[model samples]
Target: MLDVLRVTFPFFALVLCGYLAARWRLLPLEAIGGLNAFVLYFALPAMLYEFGAGTPLGQMLDPVAFTVYLACALLMVAGTVRFSLNERIRWNDAAFGALVAAFPNTGFMGVPLLVALLGATAAGPAILTILIDLVITSSLCIALSRLDGADEHGASAAARKALRGMALNPMPWSIALGALSSGLGVRPIQPVMATISLLAAAASPVALFTIGSVLARSQIVAAAAEHGPMPARDFVPVAVAKLLVHPLLVLAAGQAAIALGLPLDRFTLSVMVLVAALPSASNVSLLAERFEADNGRIARIILLTTAAAFLTFSAAVALVGPRG
Candidate 1:
C-alpha cells in the first residue's frame, strides 16, 4: 500500500542511490570501506548506546524474546549445516553456509529500518538480536568450521579467535555501558548527549547508503559466471531459509512464548519478525572469502536475497500493521 511505500521508500531509495553512485563511479569503491568503518565503529554504537541509556533495563533484557530469537537462529544454522553435509560439502564450507542462512543483517539494515518503521523502542530487541548473532551464532559457526578440520588444538584456537573478535567488537561494550548508565540512573552531560544524538541520527542514512555501495561493488554477476552454473539446488534453499523461514520461526516462537505467559507485546513481536526477515549480513561473503570457503556462492546468495528483501520486507510490514 502507499502507506507502506511512504515508510519504506527512503530506505530502499538510499540503497539504490548508493548502488547507482558506485556503478556510475560517482563514489569510488574504496571510499565505501571508510563509510562502513564509520558506521560500525562510530555511528551505530552511539545510536545503540543512546537507545540503551534511555530505555528501562528490564525492557531491554526481555528474556523470552532473546531466547526465542537465539533458538531460531541456532536451529537455522544446524539445519543448513546438515543440508550442506548431505550435499557433500566440506564441513568448513558447510559451516559458512550455515552462517549465511542464519545471520541476519541486523546491524546495517535491521536496526535503522526497524527503528524507522517502528520506533526507538524497537531498537532494544534489535540490539538483543545483534548481540545474539555476534556472540552465540558466530562463535558456534566458527567452532563447527574448525572442529572437523583439526585436532583439539585447532578447536581451541578457533574458540579463542572467535572470543577475541567478539571482545574487540564495540557494539557489545556500548550496549553494556548504556545499560549500566541506565541501571545506575547516570545521565550524560547535555553536550555529550547532544553529540551522541547527532551521531545516532546519521546511522540510518549512511549505513543504508554504504550497504548499497557494497552491493554495487560486490560484482555478483561476475562472481556467478566465474563460479560456473548457479548451484540452484543448494543456493535456492539457503536463500529461502534466510529470507522466509527465519522470520516465520521468529513469529512462531513469539506466539509460543506468549502462550506460555511470557511478556512479549505485539510491537516487540513485530520488530523481532521484521529483523529476522532481513537478508543475510554482507559480512558472510567476507567470512567465506577469509576461510576460503564458497565465496562466490555466498556472494551470489547475498545479492539475490538482498534484492528480493525489498518486496518481502514491505509485505511483512504491511501484514504486521506497523503499530510498533
Candidate 2:
C-alpha cells in the first residue's frame, strides 16, 4: 500500500542515490567508512541518550520478550550450524554463515524504518533492539571468528579479545551509558542535548545511504572476481536459515510474548518484530574481513540478503500486522 511505500521509499531512495553517486565516482567509497564511524560514535549515542532518557525503562524492559528473542536467535544459530555441518561446509564458514543469517540490520535498517513508519514513540524498542544487536547478537560474530580460524587463542585470550572488541563498539557504549543515565536521572545540559539531537537526527539517513553504497560496492567487487555465486554452495544452507527459519522462530517467540500479556507498547512490539525481520547486518562483512574469513563470499551474501530484505521485511511486517 501507499502507506508502506511512503515509509520505505525515502530510505531506499537515499540509498539508491548514494550508491549511484559512489558508482559514478562522485563520492569516495571511504566516505562510507567515515560516515559509519560518525553515526556509531556520535550520532547514534546522542539519539539513544535523548530518546532513552525519556522512556519508562521499567515498562520497556520485558524479560519475557528479551528471553524469547535471544532464545530464538540462539536456536537459529544452532540449527544453521548443524545444517551447514551436515552439508560438509567448513566449520568456520558454517559459523560465519550462521551469524550472517541470524544477525539483522537492526541499527541501520530497523531503527530508521521503525521511526518513519511507527514514529518517534518507537525509539524505545528501536534503541533496545540496537543494544541487543550490538551486545548479544554481534557477540556471535566473535564466536564465529573463532570457528573461522582466528587462531586458537586460549579462552582467556578469547575473552579478552571479545571484551576489547566490545569496548571499541560505540553502539554498546552509547546504550549502556544512556540507559544508566536514564536510570540515574541525569539530565544533560539543554544545549548539549540539542547538539546531540542534531547529530542523531542525521544518523539514520546517512547510515542507510552509506549502507546502500556499500552494498553496491559489495556487488561490484563480488562480480569482477569469480569467487563463486552469491547463494554459494557452502553458504546455501545458511542462506536458507536466514531467509526462512530465523524469521519463523522469531515469529513464534514474538507470539509467545503476545500470549503472555506482556506490557509491551505498540511501538515496542512493532520495532522488535522489525528487528527480527531485518536482513543480515552490514557489519557481518566487516567482521569477516577483519577476521580474514571468506570475505569475498560473505560480501555476496550481504548483497543478496540485503536485496532479499525488500521482500522478507515487508512480508514480516504484513504477517506481524500493525502494532496494537
Candidate 3:
C-alpha cells in the first residue's frame, strides 16, 4: 500500500496544485481553456503518437480487451441513466450524468498515469480505452440525451456532429499515424522526433495539473451561480458509480471474457479496470453546460469522484496494480 501511494501520490498532488492555483487565482479561470488546449492538442497527442508508433498495433487494439471494456462501459451508461434520472425524467441531465459516470478521464490522466504504474507496455490498453470512451461512450450518451425530445433530426444531427468531432480529434489520428509509421519501419528526422519527445514528456504532469485547474474552475463558477442546491440523491450515486461501480464492473466483465476463452490478457484487463476507475472527465461539465443540462450536478460528480480517487485509486492500484 505504501508503495502504491508512492507511485500515485505525485499525480494527485499535481491535481492539488492545479486546484490551489485556480482557487488562489494563480491560474485564472479563463486561462484554464488554454491550458486544457495545450494538453489536448499538443502534449497528449504527441505522447499518443509516440506510444502508437512504438507499440505493436495488434497489442494496442486487442479485440478482446476492447470488447470487454466497451461492454462494461455501456453497462455503466445504462445503469447510471437508470439510477440518476429525476422524477421529471430529464433525459438531458440523466444522459450527461451517465456520461460523467461512464467516461473516465482517460485522455488527460489515464494514459500517462497507467503507464507510470504499469509500464510502457501498458500504453496500448490505456490508449485503447481512449478510443472506446471518446468515440463510443461519448457519442452514445450524447445520442441518448436527445431521445426525450423525440427529435429524430436532432439525434441524426448529433450523431453526425459526434462523428465529425471524432474525425477531427488528433489523438486517434496520432495513434493511427503512429501505427502506420511503425508498420512501415519509418523514422522521422531526429529534430522532429526530438520535438515530439519534449511535448510527450510534458504530457503527464501538465495534463494532471490541468484536471485540477478545471475542477477548481468548475467549483468556483458553479458556486457563483444560483444553480440550486444539488440533489445528493441524483449526483452522489453517479459519483459512486464512476469511482466504485464502474471498475468492479470491468473486473467482472474481464473475468467473464477470460472464462469464455477470449484472448483478453491480464495486463490489458488491469489497465482497463484502472481506466474505468478514473474520475469523471472534467470536460463533461462543459458539455453539460453547452447542451443546457445541469452543469452543477455534473461538476459535483466530477469533483466528488476526483477528490475520492486519490484514496480509492491508490487502493485499487495497491490491490491490483502491476506490483501485485
Q: C-alpha displacement of 21 in model 3, angstroms?
A: 0.9
**lDDT for predicted candidate 2 compared with the true structure:** 0.69
lDDT of model 2 at position 44: 68
Which portions of model 2 show Cα errors greater than 4 Å? 86-88, 148-156, 220-237, 257-267
Candidate 2 local lDDT, 173-205, one digit each (tens): 766666677788997788987888898788888
Clashing pairs in 2: none
The TM-score that candidate 1 achieves is 0.92
What lDDT does each candidate get?
0.82, 0.69, 0.86
Candidate 3 lDDT over residue span 82-157, tens digit each: 8777675488889999999999998888878888888888888888888888899889888788777666677667
Q: Candidate 1's residue-wise lDDT over 11-99, tens digit each? A: 87888898889889899978888988899899989988998888788766888888888899999998998888855577777888889
Worst 10 residues of 2 by lDDT: 147-156
**lDDT at 91, model 1:** 77
